[model samples]
Target: MSDAAVTADLETYLSERVRSTPPSGIRRFFEIAATMDDVISLGIGEPDFVTPQPAVQAGIDALNDGQTSYTANAGRADLRTAISEELSSRYGVSYDAEDEILSTVGVSEAMQLTMLSVLDPGDEILIPEPCFVSYAPTARFAEANVVHVPTSVENNFQVTAETLESYITPNTKALFLGYPNNPTGAVLRRDTLEDIAALVQEHDLLVISDEIYDRLVYGEAHERGHVCVPSIDGLRERTILLGGFSKGYAMTGWRIGYACAPAPILRGLYKVHQYMIMSAPTVSQIAAHTAITECQDEVETMRQAYDERRRVLVDGLNEAGLPTFEPEGAFYCFPDIRSTGLTSEEFVQQLLEEEHVACVPGDAFGPSGAGYVRCSYATGLDDVKEAVRRIQRFAAKHQNG
Candidate 1:
């Protein structure tokens, strides 16, 4: 407990990377909100629904049958097979389960493994701005640089092939594609995917497609679901598709996810998975298997509820005089708060303190998010309405003054 001993321990114990990495912004908001009573949180990006009953039953059955031993590091063969079939059936992308897939603790681990597999120190990863909070930090942890490509409101926050091409450098090793994106619900069309695929091919860059929200589209039935980079010509062999049971199947706490990539990349990912995680949770894998095969109806039911909430939240925000872009997919609304003459962080803080409504500051996502705020509609209809009422009252007082 002496000063010198403490100093020596601090110096010796912490890795430089761990010392430098900032706490997650989303987590910080959650902590602050936890101290306040009567606060309605529309901030966290998680499904409010419980895991479907069938998936729960599957896990119970697995445990009752005494099937808790470690499965293969790449995951249970049956789960991987189901993932492969699900990909082909859902996205029109073919992946061989035996050689090209690896189950992960979650899409979070899959993302980190993918980056560590391909990125080296000083190599750059092209990420579209207003992305998930983890992308830049994870890239940094992999000793890679991040080059953010800014997407505009005019473009619905979708990254175009031209925008992507502008960021390519000799050191650029991969592109992080988050469609039905976090914080913003922008989605890519098939033609846009093809264009980006061609550009990535020409640049010889790998694509890491984060399609965790693929099944959460909120628009018309005729509209396309989330598009994967691998589905585009010339991109299949070079793209790593990341999926999970969290968002789509309301299985967030189960921590089940998978990655589909080319054989060689998957081999490297498996090695990483083996050492870092050993294997994903056994019971979660069982639940995930059931989710992939028999939970389509549950997915649709949740999607319909999210769709309705999305409309209610967006319409309410606009009515409150906040300029919000209509989200085509996903369960978030990114609204411009610059007109209120406050920074994104200030707006969010004041909203939490004065209105007792919690939302994430857009700037937490990236520079492109500086003037906006991300409101997630993943909660109940009643909470969404109350949050909007609070926001409207806040906006009126702020604007009038």
Candidate 2:
């Protein structure tokens, strides 16, 4: 009953993976910021906008009508049909509503389900570095070997097929993509995606494409639009597309998202989802259907606001002496902080303490993120402008350090 013995026994009870994996690098800074005054946080990724009124009303009405019970394991048929139609209209991809789509708690669960359904122990999943923090860990939780393929700001943090091919091994079974990517805010171009699709075909690998930010591409990026992975030739059968209402629709709390794939692959995800999550919240599904059917104007309004903030933040960071690549999508800008002679961890910690501006250390995403920091532009414009001012002051002090 000694303290050391008790500790040892506790350690023995948890799996090594759970014990060894570190906590999210994104959360600690936020927790610290919460305890401070006058802090401007460009840290978290949730949208600042309220959920569109129609969707909110839908949820309220559904709840008032006592529609709180679970839907079918694959989610409400109407939601699934709407999702199928939305994808078809937006991307020219068709999914059978009855069998090729499943609504889950969020893209997070869809990701977990995809990993569990398609990956086996010792299988390797190639994930580009500077990715969303959850990508590698979720695969690890599913007992897959995560190969972090490094991308750089030199190429706007994009992963090319040639680069991905170099990382492939016999054990490599899938590619996990999070385009309009987190931390870096990078989107894969059509040619690049085509190349990746070809590579996937050559390798005969499954793909888990997390496009939760699919609707958030901006300006010229929007002109090109998001290249829905399954919409690409030869990829539909092999790709699992994950999307949700959280980012673009401002429904993060609703916990509704979906996975689409060929029916057989989707059925696999459906099985895992049914057992792991009985169904997405029924009211959320109802609300999300309203989001899809009634909220296009609101979604566009939010996109325009984010686009405006994106320009200001990126330009400000560059002018502040932190070289930032213009993000084409999503709500983050990753700035190179190497000019300050500090590691990403050092820069963010010092910036937090000295300036009361909180953002995530880039290396939290992967090793390739070491010289950078992630600043989310999902907050108010004035807050972003003020954060830039604080960052400028901090950068000036340490520019030659």
Candidate 1: where are CA atoms >4 Å away?
1-13
lDDT of 2 at 95: 94
Return the lDDT, model 2, position 227: 87
Error of 1 at 191 (Å): 1.7
**Model 1 C-alpha lDDT versus the unseen true structure:** 0.90
Give lDDT tens digits, candidate 1, residues 1-401. Answer: 99999998886678777677888878787899999999999999899999999999999999999989998999999999999988898778999989999999999999999999989999999999899989988889899998999998998899999988888888999999998889898888888888888888888989999999989896752175667668888999989999999998999999989999999989999998899999999999999999889989999999999988888889999988889998887789999887788888989999999999999999898888888999999999999999999999999877633
Give the backbone clash total of model 1: 0
Write down the worst ten-residue block by lDDT for model 1: 220-229
Per-residue CA lDDT of model 2 for 1-401, tens digit only, reads 99999998888889988987899999999999999999999999999999999999999999999998879999999999999999999999999999899999998899989988998999999999899988988899989999999999887899999899999999999998889899898998988889999999999999889999999998788998898988888899888899999999999999999999988888888888878999999999999999999999999999999999999999999998999988888899999999999999999899999999999999999999999999999999999999999999999999967
Per-residue lDDT value at 94 in model 1? 97
In model 2, residue pairs whose N, Cα or C atoms come closer than 3 Å (at least 3 residues apart or on different chains), thus clashing, are none
Off by over 4 Å in 2: 2-8
